[model samples]
Target: MAIESYRLNVAEVIEETADAKSIVFDVPADLQAIFAYTPGQFLTVAVPSDQTGLAARCYSLSSSPHSGRHQITVKRTVDGYASNWICDNLKPGDRLRVLPPGGIFTPKDLNVDLLLFGGGSGITPVISIARTALEKGSGKVVLFYANRDETSVIFARELTELAGEHPSRFTVVHWLESVQGLPSLEGLSLFASYFGGYTSFVCGPAPFMKAVTTALKELGVPRELRHQEKFVSLGGNPFGDVEEVLAAQATLAEADDADEPDETEQPAAPAFAGPVAIEVELDGSHYSFDDWTGDKVLLEFLESKGVDAPFSCREGNCSSCACIVLEGEVSMKHNDVLDAEDLADGIRLTCQALPLSDKIRISYNG
Candidate 1:
């Protein structure tokens, strides 16, 4: 059987709010015949840069399927490559290659009242749900949009218009942090009083998300009613700075096979000439190899050197061989892990990892 993908024609582009733009696409006659999506599901957009094939990024649809137009809102981030490209280059009538919608962020039923919270650009998916709920006559809806300032608030005008049109059905509040320095929940409390009770959907960056969710719980909100949508998954403490753990593992590995060393243990390592490990330490195991190998990734070189590195989706999809770079640098052919903060702190996905220096130290955390 052949795999399926969705390619779309950009029909319109609307400037939703400052720093955010909404792109509407026509579901091609051929693809629309097979395309169906849940309200909160996200689509991965494949954008090719230079001569290389393409790089993909997932963005949530901001428009309701009931609206008769399929659209997604993208907020330009200062340092993000894909986001910046989309904002500056994408225009009306441009073509976009897309994957079918996939995500479990949408709420199933609309039996109860809903409280929706959106921080900055995270308003995209929440907007979709709120609109869908209204169209389906799904009880009362309250929306709280929090942002750095009014200047950067996305969908502000439309939200305001929506509130005016559905005065009794929906309530909208804007929380300005730049001028107000953290909003007092006086507005939200007033809305809650009208609804009796409601389920909450929240979305935003790490700090913003953590704060809102924490506040909801502390204010005696029920956990069952709270639904959160997060794009990046920083898997627990295992992947965080754990160089000491890697060093300890290397120590154990060294002790185990030091007495009866492998063929490349002594000197003049090997002849493959890929990402050579000048030094290796993990779980008390020590295996040293050489550098200067062409077209071989660090993880590949480690396997060739007889070090069983735990990894999956070597293209950098699963973040399986994610590790802390204790010393030296590595070049990645591609990666989804290691954001700006992680990269500054020297974390890398070992699958796409390539040695930039002759000597490098890594940990499996396996």
Candidate 2:
């Protein structure tokens, strides 16, 4: 049978760090009977909302399949809907609709040296891979975990013990962002060095990954040797304030205005008609909604029909509502998730998508 999204009951909640929590889910019998996943994939969790709060968010699995339970670690991001809600309201026995694990972050082979870097809550999948690699004795591993302070570090003791037990095969380094006079990497093997023989993996918030990748590039690390995982939709803007956002947007606008448009631009059309049939497939079922004049987006249509579709940041910044257009063409009013290749391949974010054709079919299961 084809796999589809299923609702898992929250069985236990464990506080992993100061502001982070790990939630274990009770897998249903049918799902458990056939469920299989790699180490670094993620599951999209849908938290029911009153149509006001932000929608569902995706969290990577912190625990590997070896643990025999599905678990996700969430950091309480400032103004994060799913993260904050899971921390505050979600308790044992609560049910959450969870999409199956999906992504390409998992290690493809285990015969090479692994260099892992994580910051704050981004340690989830890094730890999972390290643990599994060590257990299998697949390769040598080094982990660099950075956080605000020692107390904010999640899985500190466990990671320390793992490194201690496998001194020659494993190494763990901790960096406290709040600590001044921290040790410099003059003598130590910093990730920037590429360390001679290592397949580097990095996961963190966007800025952290960018800095690390920049350093890695400066160190002459080959692109294939470096692997980075970034959560697309950040919970909060670390830069802060609407003024900064507007300023940045102005800069982008200036840049775009300076660019020359292609001569192949299509002529602008008049107003679009509606009451079109927008068909979508979720979990093998087809849902059709009448697209009225006011209904301009696929997400709005889905929500209006009470489809319980997974989403986050209805502004189209997150791929939580990403789907493939299996049959018809749709125009994006706005989208930040898909790259050029994805758009060429017909993947679109339903949040910012509008049907150009009267008939459309989008599948979130893809």
Candidate 3:
């Protein structure tokens, strides 16, 4: 089934920094529930493109869910097409096609003390998480935000205001690379050591994220307590008709399989041949099906059954469609985001999952 997209009016635009802008969408009341998102989730926008008709890009929401606003901050990248287009062309009264909120980068419990690290535009989601936690929960929030310089900091004023409002529970530590060279692994580890017990979330440039994650690992932070968001470009247009998207994806997968060498030492398990029985738990509801013929991916099958499973980039490059296998195994056609630890934890992307067992059970509660 084709994922639904909505046209939202650009309610306002705020110039955050020299190269960053925040676009607030005016979601109609009828669609408000569909657009309601948790902090750290993102919206996929269908940007107009002459070469491809439309370019789909995901932008993290910078507005707290409790603020009754749908806002996404976009920072101009050196040669980024979508970011540049959004920063230059979007204005009040303009309508843009956008997908509903989707992502797994949110905190399960708002009351848990959080230690957040953000770099450059990655501060967008971190601020949202911070704001929501401060306004709705009773926990401390510490943000270590890094920027090129003071002038390049997005949400500098807002963060200051939040700190002022919740001085006892919120703190902001700004790191300017111009003043103090790029953060070293030793420095990061030392700083993170102070908040050893807090749940840690990191989002930043590749190098920055690498340093922070490595530091966290060396600090012996449990895998469950450390989270990182990776920014990756979608390889396919998810705004297109669902059938067409799936067909194109299948062709691409076939080509990839043909060109890649088998790297696994052991032989792969054979796919289950008979009709399978599947069970899924999502959004506090349980669903079961007895005749899953294994003809389509799990997300496609769930949508066909009227289950509103979450998904963003169906290309397995994002964790929006992630679900945990509880009782049976499923094979992924492709995966770019999940690490070995995640797979060991049974986290599979529903968008690329195919049944490998006659009876399967999964849950999206996590």
- Model 1 Cα displacement at 188 (Å)? 7.5
User: Top lDDT: which candidate number?
Assistant: 3
Question: TM-scores, in order shown?
Answer: 0.61, 0.64, 0.91
lDDT of 2 by residue, 1-366 (tens): 112457688999999876899999988667875446677767767665554222456788888888788989999989877788888888899988776765556777766888888988889989988887887656899887888887899999889889888888999878788873332343123644746657788888776766776666666777557776667654322122332535666577769877777442333232146657667788778887766332456776777778877554555555656888987677776655455646876888776676667667788765
1-366 per-residue lDDT for model 3 (tens digits): 446899999999999999999999999999999999999999999998765667888999999999999999999989999999999999999999999999999999999999999999999889999999999989899999999999999999999999999999999999999999899999999999999789998998999999999999999999889888887777677787644635766687779899677563223345566488999999889999987765688898888888988898888887999999999898887887887878998999999888899999999996
Off-target runs (Cα >4 Å) in candidate 2 are 1-3, 52-54, 180-191, 234-366
Where does model 3 exceed 4 Å of error?
242-270
Clashes of each: 22, 1, 0
The lowest-lDDT stretch of 10 consecutive residues in candidate 3 is: 262-271
Runs with alpha carbons beyond 4 Å of true place in candidate 1: 1-3, 184-196, 233-366
Q: Which one wins by TM-score: 1 or 2?
A: 2
Measured by TM-score, the strongest candidate is 3
Candidates in order have lDDT scores of 0.68, 0.71, 0.90
Ordering by lDDT: 3, 2, 1
lDDT of 3 at 303: 88
